[model samples]
Target: MSQLTIVGLGPGPRQQLTAEADAILQSGQPLYLRTQVHPLTADLPAFTSFDSLYEESADFADVYNGIVTRVLATLADGPVVYAVPGHPMVGEQTVAKLIPQAKAAGHTVRVVPGVSALEALYASLAIDPSAGLLILDALTVTPETLQPTLPTIILQVYLPRIAADLKLTLLERYPDDHAVTMVQAAGDPDVERSETGPISQIDRLGWIDHLTSLYVPPTDETVEYEPDGESIDGMVRLVDTVAYLRSPEGCPWDQEQTHKSLTRYVLEEAYEVVTAIEGDSPDAIEDELGDLLLQVVLQSQIAKEAGEFDIDSVAARQAAKLIRRHPHVFGDQVADDSETVLVQWEEIKATERAAQARVLDGVALALPSLVRADKIQRRAARVGFDWPDVQGIWDKVAEEVTEVQAAITSGSKPAIQDELGDLLFAVVNVARYLNVEPEEALRQATMKFTERFHRMEAAAKAAGQDLSAITLAEWDRFWNAAKGR
Candidate 1:
């Protein structure tokens, strides 16, 4: 039977290689090294290394495939030994692809383990991986892949450009000055080197190479899952609190509520958040946002109880959608400005929607009437269904007003209501054309009127008169005085 042996060269020096791995290397069978870049490769038996493939191939995938093809072809010559740095299973792409292909071809496979780079990294940095560790490949690192609160090690930062890109992605979740350690030739006594510095300066280092790996210690300032799972962070604790509140042993009101019963509170909490934002009160904004978040958590909990979906799945879906839509950030597509971003965003959303879905289909029906009107108008405008100019919208508003007046004069209640709605819709279009938010404009107008009415009531009270009993003329006088003030 054909045989293929895969061996690890340990992290560094031949001394670190396991006795079993040493025996396999000394078996004197045809030897192949994944790469000759490791420090101990020179001390090993004569072998062919794939170092040239790294320069010839366009990407790591291509190089890995090329290595696997060559290694499998060599099996026709009887037994073969393949060696890789660190460990055959850890961060070694070629070995992973080679094993299954060799096995399918009826070759017996043997894997000899060696000390992995992660083990070396742990020793050099004096960190314990049992606590919590996230290992990431530098080439595929992105903002979404990082968990700032966990101890992380990024491998294969072999080039300055990769390090630079990794630095930017890390900066999204970590402070620019967060301390990170870079270890090279980790377990080799003669060449091992470690440097500690701010993450922002990692790309500026002069000695990065194929053997380099970075270590980032855990931080508690950010909200993320605890490794032990015994304790919860603020957000997770809130989720637990909501779960408890809805449990049989909890609050009567919370336990009795269903998703449908809590719909109004969702809307109310959202409006309160908007009000707090408009009021420019940070504390109120924080409190109101917490209330709004409760609605989401509660809805997710209700769905979970019904065997639907939980909050984590909800967040995962949203994150996936965001990453998919944002090609400029997560992919290669370029968006130079916000307008370009919006166009790209809509294009991506259009692809996600069903072919028969209308342009306004995704707009929430539960939104305030004015806001809903604005959203509907904007959706139509995107597809060129809008009036050519503000003049046309204004003319339409005027026409609706005339029809409303005629309906009122004819004493037709339904006709009057229909025309009134048309007039309001036309007005909303006018606001859209002028780039104004109709809901916010109406809110401000209503607030202004409320303030003036309050002043009028105060004036009437000071004069010892009841506002309800005041004549129209007196009302106008007080109203005008309040408006003037």
Candidate 2:
């Protein structure tokens, strides 16, 4: 039977090669190497290497596929010995693809393991892998795959551009000034090199090559990895903190709170976030957003204790809803503009609300009256029960204003209230047609009026006159002065 033997070249030193692998290389059989880039390849017996395929292929996948095809074709001739750098099983794409295919072709396969790069890395860095460690590929690094709370080792940082891309992804979770270590030729003392510096300068190192790897230690100030199953990421740490606050040994006020009791705080925090955004201070916005997020985590914790749901489920459900509704982004649906996106969004929402008894049923009644009116008007407009244009809405506002004057002249309290509400609703419709949020517009108007009134009060105090005792003409004068200032 034709035999296929896979051997490891051990990390770069001749001493690290296994005795079993050395015996096979010296057996004078047909020898093949995955690449000739390693230090040990110079002293080895005559062999054929697939290094030329790397230059001819477009990508690593094509190179790996080409290597596997040549190796399997060579195996059909006679017994063969295939050697790859480090351990044959560790990050060797060609070896992984060749073994099963060779076995299926009625060939006996044997793997002789040698010292892997990970073993040499541990010895070079003097770090224990028993602690939490996250190993990632530089080519495939992503925000979702990174865990900054654990000591991470990134492999295959073969090029400067790959390192630069990895640095950007890491910067999302790790600070730019965070310390990182680069190691090259881990076990070979003759040519080994290691450097420690800020992650921001990783791509500037000129000595980086195919053998280089990066090490990022966990940042305790940003996020911590708890061995007791308490936390793994920043969000998980927040969830754990909230869970502890509701525990028996935790805060009394937090332990006594229910979901219903926390509703008011949720609304208050949301409004404070809006106020902070309006103030346009980054620090205030971040703080207020954290406060708002706390409410969500706390409510999720309460639900978890009640066996209802948790934060993970809430986030997953929301993610699913967003992906499902955004077919233009997540699917093949094409939406070129914001208006088209909104139309697609509403169509998706309408399908989700298909079980509802009415078009306006999902608009919460607890929303502010102006916001609720805007939502109600939008819902009606979707069903074609709306004015054709902004001009029609303006005409309706004038008609409602006339009715309010007639009702006030008739001296009917209910009639006046009804007409005033009609006029406000018509105005809200005009605001919606103009693409303005009525609630936010009214809030800005109210704030401006309050500021001007305070200025008028100051003017009255400076003139030694009580505001209540001022005549209409005097009030007008003060108001004009305030406006001018």
Candidate 3:
């Protein structure tokens, strides 16, 4: 037979206590109360309480562990009734941890339910929880854990310090003047008292104890985690983490970084992501992508601090752009192929920016020269200033190369530099005509050259000759060997 019985004391009122709980307490067996702090305990039969654990322990975990240890030890002798305030399963940390371990160790455990703070809170606040309600334990609460759009009830506000901590956390999401209700001795009509004021004054409510609970009303906007228990892919959690990092209590280095300061990091992370993708390692790509996302979040956090924008605004803008651009996917538009999609996308962009003065007005100056040149030529093509075909582009490349050769023969440095730039631009046009991104093509070409160069170095080392000491002819021999390999 099971020797352990867990029961709730029903929010400290004799009338509110359940018949089963009362019968168990009066069964003439060894009864143990978690604490003697409740109002209903005075009218009950004499029993041992674990109130001393609270005074002697270092933390709540220690106190709860001590209670569990004592309960398990006493259960070895005979059957015992363990009573706690409110429902045994609701905000009862000791019971939550104890029951599972006890049952697994061959002890039979039974729980008798009683009135929880949810019921008491509803009666006191006069609100329906069905609309949207978030129940949380105050001890483990944070701004990220809070769903601000739902009416929230936080239980186990057992100390003034905990209340102050909760108030600070709430201030991160709620305005300082946001109203909150503090209910004490819930469900006990004689001792039940309620106070309403700004959340900032939570610590000053004068009477905070195990029975106290806080009720927070919904805000104007919805929370990231909806009240329906659905998770939105962790975007909200990431946003909240970035916000906390930019807060006054956040890291000093993170707080000092502005949008301009983070630009270099953004560029570096983007390059790393490209490298990772090219390496064909999925784990590396995922890690590099996370780093790139950090740069975006950091910039948004800085912008939010300046009162300019936030992650949500950035996401909303991109979402709207995607919906607008993909008319075939989101609207009644037909695009049978990738080429048609590109044409429609460009047309949509042109219509959106009809007031632009120049064709290249939207092209960023910070883009790589090759990519910027490609964009410029594409934009110019839309305005009727491009080659008619790939042959024309090839001819242009040949003409630019001739000009560069003539400039070099004449020994004019400036003319040579100008002609070389024109040659590179012509090559970019050729790449574009071949339906390849010039910058990406160049990057791949460079990586291939680097691999061949390293192979040549390794061949030189295997031949017991350093490349620096070898002649140009010997270098060519190793280079040719690496090429053939």
lDDT of each: 0.85, 0.86, 0.84
User: What RMSD, rounded to one decimal, does every model reach?
Assistant: 15.6, 19.3, 19.5
- Candidate 2 global lDDT: 0.86
Tens digit of per-residue lDDT, candidate 3, span 17-134: 9998999988888989999988878888879999998778744556888999999889888888999988999989889988987898789999999998789889989989888899
Q: Which stretches of candidate 3 lie over 4 Å from their true place?
A: 1-233, 409-412
TM-score of each: 0.51, 0.51, 0.55
- lDDT value for candidate 1? 0.85
Give residue 136's lDDT in candidate 2 (0 to 100). Answer: 84
Model 3 compared with the native: what TM-score? 0.55
Worst 10 residues of 2 by lDDT: 223-232
lDDT order of candidates, best first? 2, 1, 3
After the best TM-score superposition of candidate 1, give how far the Cα of residue 210 lies from its true spot, in angstroms: 44
The candidate scoring highest on lDDT is: 2
Which tens-of-lDDT digit does each residue in 290-369 have in candidate 2? 99999999998776555456676688789999999889899999999999999999889888889999888989877889
